[model samples]
Target: MQLVAPLNSSLRRVPPGWVYLAGLIPLAWVIWLTVSGGIGIDPVKEIEHRLGKIALWFLIGGLAITPLRRIAGLNLIRYRRAVGLIAFFYIVLHMLAWIILDMGLLWEQAVRDLIKRSYLYFGMTGAVLLLPLALTSNNASVRRLGRNWRRLHWLVYPAVGFGVLHYLWQMKVITPEGWLWAGVFAGLMALRFRPFRG
Candidate 1:
């Protein structure tokens, strides 16, 4: 913990803006790949998958904050909001790519696919749950909502669970990486319980 203390002290000196800026680099990388015809044959699907994967990583990163602080003595409390909002940004882009590019804005086809694909429900449910959290993420809303703000933010746990399931179920065969993420999610959730921590 003593060794980590110095690193944590340096992290505290860094502003959350740095995290936000770093997040954009991936989006730009994804864009460049797609533009250069480097994103594989199905560019739309590639971009969508890349964006959603980025969002999932950020979502998991956001969820890990509390456990990291408690167990590893690392603090990133200030950047959680930025991490969450960036996750939501990629989520929105992922959905838009599916709708506009993949589905060609065809409401009928999109609806049919949504109905036929159960995994889509999990993804959509997670996004819908995140909407309120993103809307109230501002300082003004934090002051306005008071105690309810925390209650509303608790929606993130279910959103993350749905997201994990969405990712796993969409894959025909879950990869080792997917299983690892599931394990990480379970561990983080367990750490939130006093009994498990004990």
Candidate 2:
């Protein structure tokens, strides 16, 4: 296709490692804002929200890679692992911000919140789902797992669904942004079905 050529040409010029390095820019900016006291009155909440949002964006980006390659003939497979790892890194930071800054590592209260709050439960479930996928993102695991590797990575779909639900529930009122993310997640999932697999 006419569009594919230009897109592939442009992508070919940029190394996947560069994309990985560039992904750190958001983290750096967040750190700078935190140090400069620019995160407003509630720094913990701000940091947590920002990290969670970034994680979701990266998750969406990683998911998009397959569809992009299939429909647009743009192969960015090389960067999927980096995108996934960056997403996991942000997910960890998001949890840390909640545990250290928000809950002060109060296990009893944290457990109570997890049990009482649906949003917290969704978020925790999403994080737990991501743990195994993150652990096995390396090439060695892929070689060892072989066919099972694909099945293991399929966990990302549900993990992302849980993540979107977590985001929706966490919001006090569903905003347009929340709906947009949900729609995007739904569309991406739909694309994975047989009809769109072609």
Candidate 3:
């Protein structure tokens, strides 16, 4: 607890803007890798997968903030919005990679894929859930919506669930990574119950 105090204090000294700027590094690196032919044979699929996985990572990170603060006495509340918006940005990029590179701007094919693919359906559902949350992430929206804003952002839990399910369903066989994320999601959700609250 003593060591955690200094760490938390140090983290508090860092600006949220710095974190937001740092968050763009992953996207930039992925773009650079794609341009430099460094993303392996199937660059398009790699790009899409990388972006989607990063988005899920950020989503999970954002979800972990509250639990981290409550259980570990670490405070990072200031960066939660930035983390969530970064996740949304990656999600958009992931969809764009699929639509532009994978589907080649073919709406009919994309729509067909959306209809036939359960993973796509789950991913799309997660995207739709995130849309409003992203739109209302600003301070103006918080002021405008008042208490409703909190209720609206609660959608993140379901959005993350769908995102995880999309990832799990996309794999032909469940990997350790899939189980790890599922366990993390389950643990985070469990922590939200009254018994776990401190």
Estimate TM-scores for all models. 0.96, 0.94, 0.97
Q: lDDT tens string, model 3, 1-198?
A: 788889988997899999899999998999899898899999888999999999999999999999998998889899999999999999999999999999999999999988888899899999999999999999999999999999999999999999999999999999998999999999999999999899
| Candidate 2, 39-82: lDDT as tens digits | 88988889999999999999999999999899888888888999
lDDT of all predictions, in order shown?
0.94, 0.92, 0.95
Query: For all the candidates, what are their Cα RMSDs to the real structure?
Result: 1.1, 1.4, 0.9
Superior candidate under lDDT, 1 versus 3: 3
lDDT of 2: 0.92
Q: Which scores higher on TM-score, 1 or 2?
A: 1
| Candidate 1 TM-score, true structure as reference | 0.96
TM-score of 3: 0.97
**Tens digit of per-residue lDDT, candidate 1, span 1-198:** 988899888998899999999999999999899888899988888998999999999999999998888788889999999999999999999999999999999999999999999999999999999999999999999999999999999999999999999999999999999999899998888888989674
Descending-TM-score candidate ranking? 3, 1, 2
**Candidate 3 wrong stretches, greater than 4 Å:** none
lDDT score for residue 172 of model 2: 87
